[model samples]
Target: MSDQTGSAGVVLKYTVSPDDFTRAGEASSKVKNILKQMGISPDVIRKVSIAMYEGEINMVIHAHGGEITVTITPQEVLMELKDVGPGIEDVEKAMKAGYSTAPEQVRALGFGAGMGLPNMQGCTDEMKVETELGVGTTITMSVHMEDK
Candidate 1:
């Protein structure tokens, strides 16, 4: 793989629209394609892609949309998603594997299985979630790359 043995850092940014199921995965797809082009190992690419997609979907469904920024380097890939919606009330409960607060409409759409944060945590090397009740939430995640 041409994993850019000594390349400089690359940064990618995307805006996720609220409740836009039609376009939900666009940003994550773009990132996955870019990672493939960069020759990132498939394993790392899969982890980053899954984690970021989950975060993106969460923003679309819960956060009234948000912004995602991805920074890639030889050592790791870092993702940050920020949103300005009604913040999560209980982060501890939200981290549970099947706990979800999504409304029935969203569930009818088959979008909210309450697995987003859990899947993200499982896929990333490191993850963080910061939120305030009336303010917003920001999630940051990273995936470490294998030695080239």
Candidate 2:
């Protein structure tokens, strides 16, 4: 497989729209395509794609809107999603499975089953979330190809 070598990494950025559930997965879809074009393995691509997609959906549902930046290198793929939403108050509780602040309408849409964060963790090599009350949240996720 021809993965990015040396300094030949690629960077991509996407803007997420608020309350736009229909377009929630668009950013992740683009990222997945780019990874494929770079010849990254399907497994790695899948992990990164799923994790980032979940993050994107969360941002749209919870945050007003956000920006997602993805960086690809020979060793790893990294994604950072930043949003200016009501920050997660209890990150520890939020990380737990079946924990979510999504409204009933969102639940009716078949989402907000509280698996977004859990799914993200399961799909990535490493994930970190930072937030402050009334400020915003920024999530950094990385998938290391070397681990394969």
Candidate 3:
């Protein structure tokens, strides 16, 4: 998707494809590049990259693809991931390290170590998850920009 800028902020939109491990990190990479080009602080860039990458991978592995919208402003970066796949059953359990519901096949790929949510939380200043058992899930994360 094309990037857009408006009074609200600079918005970047991407579509994560299911089971596409080879292309999974494209969005995060693009965002990182944009942040770098914008001269954002390295710390904030690093945090946003890690959190967005983890969320993108989760969408690919569990959610069967989704949409990622990132809004960058002077104060903070906001990332929203929305998917229509099977929703998370337990948010708490999912947040725990080494606890995962990913299938054996997914684990074989060296992913699904159950660190996705935890790592995302660790990197972002704020995060929120909304899910329904059979419906879908949406995760919103934010990393506040710090004064240099």
Candidate 4:
């Protein structure tokens, strides 16, 4: 971890492993724990945790593997996920609930329900997805924090 100099927040980075369902939530858990230690409100922590977790799952199931950068500031929490894999074919179609490209086996593992992106969107104040077929995908999500 780098020094938190000149920055109003903490930036945490994690490398995600593809197809690692058992460890999917590890990054999110760590972020949530850090937020708790920092005394962030439960609502804000939940929003950040859930959104990042979905992004993590997306990376594992769709992008093989990826990197997540989470920045926590007094004003907002920002999460950026970048991956090198087959990008999303249709962002609109993928955003719909119950739509999934995950294989049957992945579905049996309790993921690929097609709600990852939507849940991410719902949890954050703003969400942006940049992807190119056969290239890669990057998702940025942010949630604002209220004055305590």
Candidate 5:
């Protein structure tokens, strides 16, 4: 880990709206800009942005939107995404690279190629997904900073 700059960490929150395709990635983009302004490493920013954006898209397409909380510190960047939509029936299946539960409508939009979870797991240092069939889901992911 690198920086210990933020005393407790800088926290940012955002809301994802159902079917808000137009604004789906706004929060992630804003975070990327903020990271840049804070002089975060490019690799870290890229990983964080990719994970956050994928989560946002998943919420819009399957989970009927959700809320996202991100904490930035010198040591790492953490993001937690929560949704109240139908939870993943099979976490194992959903984690498959090409597996998608999106309906035809979502697929037709060219956004549901089943890569959200895979990509999220790929770029982050650690990731966790907690879900209930009809209750909701919460995904927590973190990307740790490293010494150059």
Candidate 6:
């Protein structure tokens, strides 16, 4: 399903599966395609895609699964990821580079570099994270559109 604004912008949603390395980047890839079809700038698309991809992977490795909603408008692209996995205990520690809690099997696959949250923050113009110890985590990120 999608929501339309005055300018015909689009909102897309995807469900992430647990430990699904083979399909990890699918959601981000789809978002990139949608942005391209809408004639969004490549730079903006790149930033959103990278951030979304990282979040998706984190959901797979840590959260077991999650849901992501992406909203594209004339002004910015917003991505919201909600997961039912163990919530982050320390947001500050999690944000540090080279710090990861991923299992060995996951790290062997060339992921779990401890860069997911940081990378997401770096790529987005705005970001907010809400997490509960045993409940879940929700991350909202936005990338503003730039004039061509």
lDDT of each: 0.89, 0.88, 0.94, 0.87, 0.90, 0.89
The candidate that achieves the highest lDDT relative to the unseen native structure: 3
Please provide, for model 1 over 81-115, each residue's C-alpha lDDT reduced to its tens digit, 9 standing for 90 to 100.
Answer: 99998999999999998899999998998868889
Q: Which stretches of model 3 miss by more than 4 angstroms?
A: none
lDDT of 5 by residue, 17-133 (tens): 888888899989988998999999999999999999999999998888999888887789999999999999999999999998888988888878889999999999999999999
lDDT of 6 at 17: 80
- Among residues 3 or more apart in sequence or in different chains, the pairs in candidate 3 whose N, CA or C atoms overlap within 3 Å are none
* Model 3 lDDT on a 0 to 1 scale: 0.94
What total of clashing residue pairs does each candidate reach? 0, 0, 0, 0, 1, 0
Clashing pairs in 2: none
For model 5 the local lDDT of residue 47 reads 96
**Model 3 clashes, total count:** 0
- Using alpha carbons, what is the TM-score of model 6? 0.93
Q: In model 5, where do residues sit more than 4 Å from their true spots?
A: 1-6
Q: Model 4 shows how many backbone clashes? A: 0
Error of 5 at 36 (Å): 0.5
Model 1 ranges with Cα > 4 A deviation: 1-8
lDDT of candidate 6 over 64-100, digit per residue (tens): 8899999887899999999988999999999999888
- TM-scores for candidates 1 onward, in order: 0.92, 0.92, 0.97, 0.93, 0.93, 0.93
- Predicted structure with the largest TM-score when compared to the true one: 3
**Candidate 5 lDDT trough over 10 residues, lowest sum:** 1-10
